[model samples]
Target chain A: MAGTDKQQDMLAEGPAIILVEPQLGENIGMVARAMANFGLAELRLVAPRDGWPNEKARASASRADHVIDAATVYETPSEAVADLNFVLATTARPRDNFKPVRGPVEAASDLRSRFAGGQKTGIMFGRERWGLTNEEVALADEIVTFPVNPAFASLNIAQAVLLMSYEWIKTGDQAVTPPEQALAPAQKLHIESLMGYLDNVLDERGYFRTEDKKPKMMENLRALFTRPGFTVEELAVLRGVLTSLEKFSPRNPRGSGAPER
Target chain B: MAGTDKQQDMLAEGPAIILVEPQLGENIGMVARAMANFGLAELRLVAPRDGWPNEKARASASRADHVIDAATVYETPSEAVADLNFVLATTARPRDNFKPVRGPVEAASDLRSRFAGGQKTGIMFGRERWGLTNEEVALADEIVTFPVNPAFASLNIAQAVLLMSYEWIKTGDQAVTPPEQALAPAQKLHIESLMGYLDNVLDERGYFRTEDKKPKMMENLRALFTRPGFTVEELAVLRGVLTSLEKFSPRNPRGSGAPER
Candidate 1:
């Protein structure tokens, strides 16, 4: 069995990627790489110009060689998407012969629900020169396109695939309930307390000379410290340094006063 | 008498930054930098923090020293806005106390229109620690807040300043106009046509064939040419080489078939 087939069997739910009349082997490789980024393994190629199993495609796949090795090649789009229950076609230019067009987010959400119900879903991408032809687009249930800068909307093939993959991953079941043991950064309250202690120490040492402006001065200090979003361990270290400074300072009643100025 | 004064004088209308009880010199300096980014020069400090004109503040101001030099110091929020006809306070937390509330875009547009009508408008940013005290928020004619990440809305002082400044600049007369006379790239259409001709000639000569699927041999050739969004000049040089290749080929109709290989 091919590596991609093994990967697909292992997954609880994941979508298939279909490339129709993909002219370049490198682009096919890049699409596989993008698919791997979002954990999608199955890749179906329809009538590639360079033939199947090109070395250039393997090299471009990089860490995703498994995806390239397992890619299935077919003579036409119909054969490629024959098994898919739901399919989405991606294109930049709007077609006059339209199906219901959904943005990336909506398409991802619908696909997620469909996958949850144990239905197979696939997304089709067309050639770089001329995107999916009108006939090819008509085969899909829905059309997908990115909300890009209107004047510069010509996206590289891999970039378009990556965006769609990202949205799908975000909407997937695995994303909803993230792992319980996942570590998050220290909370805001802990950082606030550390800042308060540091300001109090500074105040005790006569660092804040102007009494009327001390409140405003402390606020600015808080802003600077809070911006970095320090962790508990980092805050503890900073507090320790402040404590040591207080003990060593000449202003301390127990320490030597203004030595060798 | 300073650079900021000259800038303010040059612009018949400009946005005023009212910083309420700002605590740190560094943050004040950073706020100045943010203001300068959006062409906002006037800075009003209400009870600033390490006292007015601290050396640390000036150092933090970096290239925005003019904003620091031109800043006006006031003791209270009311005192800060007494001279301004329109005042907008920036706050994150919503309060029950009644006041006209506007989001960043609306607030920026309101300020722009007010300025155009010769009304002096000031935007108030509260102290970082507690934000604007309820009493301080009450002092303003309107309140403005940003549409930030709801889960983590704790924006840095300078970041907040930059966002507001960006909106204000975008809405104001200082908006960047689209460039006139769209200039095409150096290479023109003729060069591209030549490159296409070369590609066809190379294909006919079987330059891309290797120990692979001969039927789909054109894929790798398409990949190379698809890249390098080339101009007309580059294509001409490539075409010249193809012409030389055709002349040298032993299969040329006018020449004796000499096996060059």
Candidate 2:
């Protein structure tokens, strides 16, 4: 169960994302999956060109059944945001209008405040080939755009949704630290003890020659063992290997290669 | 020309995203789209379940035609990332090993620094249903996992790619500002003139009656005009509306209901 809960928290609610004239069902499905990744639900489709409930889209959604099931259909962009008090339209190009424009971060902050004040807000995404029309953009209070590379700014519908959703989740206070480490790491002392045992065995074997250089040789040996920062299990395995090799030493009193004990 | 320039940036070189045994062509295409969104260009597929040259994948890629076009296929994940100096393996469940585990932000930062040092790097994503195997995870220098909800930590393939790609772009030094405004905003004097014209029309219409309430009413009117933070074009539209209403007045000798030349 601890494995399952690693830094995972309950899902959060977010504004509806309305996709207008989306061309592919696969894009629709991927958008749903992207939204779910950031704990967002409530998807709106405004007259998809290929229509809704396509098998290809459903298959592509992977495991996000709830999003696909709860997705709502609308006849127009205005109809999609009819019940919302505020709306933001996503565009790649800056519009020639006076509406306040915001990058994804600012837009996400504004959406968070609006949601906190008990306002129904939604984001409208235009068609895949061409984004929202001027008439459609006029319906929104603000425009949200990505600060993308000027030389290559074409972002698919799902990528756009993912960026916004990621920012929204990041704004909220969630414990982003990895889940409590699954296993307790072995301490330095544990490795030191293992090193001491191995050193004694090596001393008997004449592995450390030149009495004057013994200290430096021991230090080098310790460094090698500590480099990978072995876990307790790894240390145990190394101890087993050493004991087994000592048994086959022929230095043992037993005529056979087994340890006398 | 700017619109066309958008799709032409020499794709920002980043880590190779190797998909090990990806099942569907649709998932592969979506992954390519996600990679392109943030300038990541290298895609290596290892023994895909559905084989190569998938039509579904090509179609789903949308405008990431280049990514899919240059995608390379490999016999295994090891082969895919063999040429890179460093590799990262993604896994949903925590492994019982001593490998350093990083969240997306830290991983992106590390990848950025490594790229700066002229080292080739890559990240491996596992199959659709079950993630990377233990042996495969063992081949990496580090592991990265999303801090998703414990109850539902499953993120589809494309979503995983999107998250990593988003972080990669975010950590870079590129100017993340929106392009220059298409139309420079109107000066304060323009809005002031429009506000003055509207006030005169309202006074003539007897909308601001009680003298004591005039100042408060006027202050409220000014606040309303500035609330949406109108652009110059918006002010022009408001001024046009006021002139149109003043036309039916019989107060104007301009029979055309238009302002005098």
Candidate 3:
């Protein structure tokens, strides 16, 4: 409650990530982290080997406590997905069933459309080692598989969830903002002013050596400075540095551009 | 070599994955697994904390041995990606720099298009504790980030790699076949014939009791059966079940739908 500022719970309405007999607490924690990273909230655990309220899982979750805290535990996969209208069981290998198989993107798209239609949809992930059994795969409406290397297609539980969650976030309408503490980019005029000031200081330092090549050299210098595109804060910092250098000239103390000391 | 057959290396020519001072062997292994899952081959390490050839890493990698085996080590970030024409640094937080910022999808598309133009492209991932230094990020042509939940945006190293690798695979022209060993769907006529046979059997068994509601009930049952669009295998299985049920009739020896036992 202290760290988490709840704002209508943007992650409340996505597909449930039901982990069936997940082995390691660390993997579960990592899965929760991945889910949180992609704004997926609902987490259902079916018969975890190490039991519930796992300390190791909470520790590894790294402040994704919301996912862990709100997690629901069930005894079987059927019970885990009982409330959902549609379920997708994720498996690496193909099963001997006729269920439609979807890649992550297509599955996510389906999940988005289904969620929009008020359908309670969930995606089930199997265990770390053996993956989902054919019987377990039969319970789902469809199967989801990662197009992994056929020779060695064993993906850890968290990795599989991450792929699905990433696609879900990408294809869904959630707005995930990159964490930022920086200022907005400066206007073009502000950047040009910074460049003009720097050019004046460089000229005073005789940085433009050849008279005939001065314009081209100045143009190249300007191009180089502006190549990466300066932000407002960055331009301000550059201006501060240039002003500092300008103060170093004794005769032109305030950067008057007088030929001096 | 026994398990992994070389097939002109579909993963060889894509973007490089440069890890800068990655801390854990488990994370490295997971990263390799994520890369292999998406067919990204090139891995460059910049001074890993536990050093390379780590047994823990190899063990955790599952069978992404090629990613770990062909991994290259360097002393610095610049040295790690020195051969690349373009580099994108991954970060959770925005840095005070002038580099262009792109989300994973946009970045992967750029990587794909740039690699198509014969330019070697790479993406840099930072350490576990602290991300890439500002100087390290400055060396990159652009910054790539996961559009993650700002409230708790700390994604583990492997999750970052998986998202990027997934995008790379999505935007690239690699043949990623889902492991499907099933038959094509049956014809509409076949399904209709099966349905008619089953209807006759059910009718003899008095499954449709009320005459007034019989048509609506039959229509609903037909819709339910047809909704999933059964494949040939599924239809065959259904037909076998129907025939087995028919054999229970007493009046007919070979399930002729004559009621009486």
Candidate 4:
């Protein structure tokens, strides 16, 4: 059921994943698997070193034969992307060009918006050892790259496919999230009541060192409680914590306040 | 330089990546490569399928010897993540529980914020086939999952690592971007000048058929131009387009406007 064409429509259709001069068939197979995971079915290969119809790619593609079977081959990168209205070339290295260079997230939004307008889009991935040449990148509308450790910037071709494909499905998404984790924000009146209780306890415990500094310290405490607006549950837990501390106060010692049961 | 310890510090240190009862050594190797690409060095393995000191994993790990050689093996999943203060379990399948299940991007933010607070964190990936047991997920503080086609939601162990590692580096990033591609916005006066020129040309071209609807049409045009303010270069191009179109106007024939080219 997962391999059928009918079920493939469950995920949104996305930009093409094009590979230019990919050397190894195993890498091609891995790229197919990556695309399948992200709901991207269209795969384009240009001047593959091992050529099309190779058995190695078939063996490595796991069960994602649909992407590999429908994969198209073209003579040049230009001919491969000629039908695409917009093309973004992926390169690991920075280039000296005026074309917009965006990270994966921003580029995903650009592709998604263009998709909404009914425009066809494609992202080009260059060769394994030698990435896209300047001439080939010139054919693209923009440049899109990845985020890797500058110390070890290398990303295998299959890994690069996974990153871009993952972004293609994630950007511009409005999917339902898991069950709500946060409760409603605490009301100002409720928070002020808790603050007053805390202030009274702190005064009883001699937490205020100086009379002149009391107002400034209280102002800081108020800001901390109101800064980002904690959830009602969070506020409740905080109040309970202060109430627990009040029982341990020296003025009302917990060990002496209650006799041994 | 890219592989040395001194160079590793170029990227910020992130959470440990823990694999629980992984089945394949090659998959383990690929995970190391993915983590190294994103500047994460800590790796912990819990009861690997073939036990410790496996040759297949080493062969698959590329040249990320720092991560592969230093990996520590533990007896159980609990022992593997015992030292970490915050833990996230990665799973493709959902469970009927209250644990917050976050998408990769949001989970990345959660991890990074805790990182800012100096709390140690780790993310656990389960067996290649079975994924995490409910009991194993119970050990984690939250759950993190990927964006994949629900029809074909399977992600190979290595591919899953690549997606999470990519997000680990991207979230909360303050890295330098490539040279800016956009020019400054056009001054309001300059934009209005081009708008006037465009109105004149459209009037000469009889673009407005009804006088009553003209105001609404022009109002739409004004909003279109100002809604997302165009840049100076954009305004210049718009004016030039109108100037070029003015020549072909039927009212002012370019055929007899001046000398022929």
Candidate 5:
């Protein structure tokens, strides 16, 4: 009750990650962490082999206590998924059930659509050793399998959960934000000044000996500098590099102008 | 020289997964398992804190023995990626460097293109605690970050490896295969016979006494049985379900023909 930030529950309204007869407490812990990594908070357990409030699981969660603490346990898979309108059963071996088979990416999109339609969704994972039985697989609406190497198609419970969870979050229109806390990009004025200094320095060093070809070379140089749109700090670093190189120049001093000089 | 079946390497050719100064052998082992799940084989380590040939990592890798057995180690990030023509560094924190940032999907596309051109590529992951140093990140071409929950952005070594491996595998033009070795579908003639039997049973039970509605009801029943394309085994299972349901039907007895009777 102390961590009653209930708003988090609704905001992170990701699909419930259901583990049916999960064997290890450590695996449960990792599953919880994987869910947290993708902003999924709801967790359900159907007859866990190890009882709840497991200390090992808590330790393994690596601080995803929100998912661990709020986890609900059920006596059966049907009860675990009773509230879900859209359920996906994850399996490695192909099933004979003839249910629509989907990959994790497609399943993510499906879950997102269902969630938007005000439907509660969940994913069911079976036991560690074997996997979901035919009866258990029948509880879900569809089967979602990974496109793994046929020779080595086995994925540990946590890794499987992470793959699905990773896609679930990826389905959202979350644009990739550029690096945060990064320096602002340098203005065109700053880039032009840096380019002028570099041109003067390069000309002084007789680097443009082929007279006619120098125009295209200068164009290429300008493209390279303008392309990256260096940040303010980066422009300074470039100036520093130029200054350090000029220090070794016995022919010219550290003066900013060279071609004009 | 012993395992010179290099063609397997080319067919399963994937970008190298580099761990820089990873601390634990167990973590490295899980990383191998994660990579193998997506059919990635190349693994490079830069000065693993626990050293190579670690028994803990070997056991932790589950059964990804090929990846573990062939894993290469280097003294530094540079040496580790020396043979690679392109590289992408993964990070959670935003760096001040003015490099172009990409999400995992874009990074996977980039890797695929480089791989197509016969150019080797690798992805660099930083240490567990702090992550790739600014200096180490400078070694790569660009940064690829996950669109994870900002509230909890920390992904353990194996989870990070899994996300990248998953995206890499998804970028390929792989199509989803249907379930494996399922029973042969019950013929359409069989479905018609089953439907006709059901109609007689329902009529005998006085379920279609509403004469005008009986045709529509029978049509719906036919559609239901025909929709699933149940296999021979599945058709038998359905008959079993019907038999069990009929046992409770006090009035009607089990008979071969349906509405005909």
Candidate 6:
């Protein structure tokens, strides 16, 4: 029952994933799995090193064989993306010739909106050994790149695909709430307000003096307060302590700093 | 030279390294090395199974003997933290009565500010075999926990110290500019401008129909743009494309968008 619905969903509103000169069948399969993760099913293979319909590719695809089965084979990248009104080429390295580059999140959001507007979009990923050639990148309307650690920028094709797909899925499903963990809405707000009150009190005490240093100081304070995810009642108790301190301080002659403490 | 400065710094504002009954001397030395990696030099031994000042620890410390040299021996956890105004106990398992837990980033920020204000702050980490006892955790003002994969939370002492040190160094040196790599600054601004232009064009075209949804859409777009850190020139070119699109569209009869293009 899930399989049928998945296939139907794949047929509708899915972007075409074009792999350019992919080397390994394992990578191809992994890419298929990644595409499936974000509800993308249409895979277009453009000139592979390991032949299409290979068992290795199918095995690597795991449960995402539906995407592999539904894939379209293409002789060239241009052919694969010919029908696409919008094409985004993925690369880690920057191009010498300037082109509009968007991060995964922005590109995903744009693609989601465009897809909803009846625009056919194709996101192209390069091979493992070397990324997309200069000529190949020039063919796309826009470039897409992932923000990765510079020291270890070389990403396995599947990981790149997964990150991109995750962002795309997030942008596409705006209403779907992410998995709920410990932090909730009320707790978050209460924490923020508590931090705000603390900041105000600290500022009055001249704790953070340097003008240039204020932003960092406040950020450090906020980071400390927000991390705990305090409840409303917990915050109220903290505020009471602050009020008691203000009242007890001998400097406050008129009790302007004091509350009902 | 480095060793002497490290020792002096440790004496001045050294972070209290509480090892809760750590078994191995090699692990302690590795922790010292990891601490030195981020300017943390203070070493506190809390009821270690192995005797203090072990040769194996000195060997592992390598050039970071300053940490091992200034190490303070403690028979109990309470004695180790008696001088500290704020004490944070690190653990993987959550306790019901434990003070609210925070991630490393928040904990580091809190420690930095507290230390700056002349408050003695100590962060207690658990041993390899068995972590900090619930009774030990109850003595802490806060609990510090790393966000690790739940299935595999068993981190080596040195690795845990390294992670915490990384966060501490980042928070402590908040004003220090990160080392610049390739990808020119101009390109970054260009990317920003291009994103702005695209958003404006989309807005003018009524692409964002719902007023309520506009802020969220814009925020998502901003997140997408900012994540990759684009150059100004890149942003400018992106904006040019948006301008061209706005000019060519049927709704906007004028060619005003061509100016930037």
TM-scores, one per candidate: 0.35, 0.58, 0.63, 0.65, 0.65, 0.38
Evaluate candidate 4 and give its CAPRI docking class based on DockQ: medium
For candidate 2, write residues B1-261 as lDDT tens digits: 122233454655888889999999988998887787778878899999888878889887766777787788988765676566667889996786557789887898878876765657788999999988875775566789986644445587888888888788877874333423433334334545665686787777788887777765665564455434355787888877677667654555556565542
TM-score of chain B of each: 0.63, 0.63, 0.64, 0.64, 0.63, 0.63
DockQ of each: 0.01, 0.14, 0.26, 0.49, 0.28, 0.01
The CA lDDT of each predicted structure is: 0.65, 0.73, 0.74, 0.76, 0.76, 0.66
For model 1 the local lDDT of residue A179 reads 23
What would the per-residue lDDT of candidate 4 be over residues B115-166, giving only the tens digit for each residue?
A: 7656678899999988887667756667888878887777987888888888
* Candidates, ranked, TM-score: 5, 4, 3, 2, 6, 1
Write the residue-wise lDDT of candidate 4 on A1-261 in tens digits.
234577765663778889999999999999988888888888899999988988899899887787888889999886787667667889897676546788988888767776765657789999989888875665566788887888877798888888888888886473423323444345445556666887898877688888887865665565556544465678888987877676655665565666222
Candidate 5: deviation at residue A154, Å? 1.8
Determine which window of 10 residues in candidate 6 chain B has minimal summed lDDT: B182-191
CAPRI-wise, candidate 5 is acceptable
Worst 10 residues of 6 chain A by lDDT: A179-188
For model 4 chain A, the run of ten residues with the poorest summed lDDT: A175-184
Residue A119: error of model 5 in Å?
0.6
- Per-residue lDDT, model 3, residue B202, is 80
lDDT of 6 by residue, A149-185 (tens): 2322435576567656655665654653333343221
List fnat per candidate, in order. 0.00, 0.22, 0.50, 0.88, 0.58, 0.00
Give the residue spans of candidate 6 off by over 4 A: A1-12, A175-261, B1-261
Considering every candidate listed, which one attains the maximal DockQ?
4
Better of 5 and 6 by lDDT: 5
Q: Score candidate 6 by TM-score against the native.
A: 0.38
Q: Whole-model lDDT for model 4 versus the true structure?
A: 0.76
Question: Poorest 10 consecutive residues of model 2 chain A by lDDT?
Answer: A1-10
Query: What ranges in model 3 sit over 4 Å off?
Result: A1-8, A174-261, B1-10, B174-261
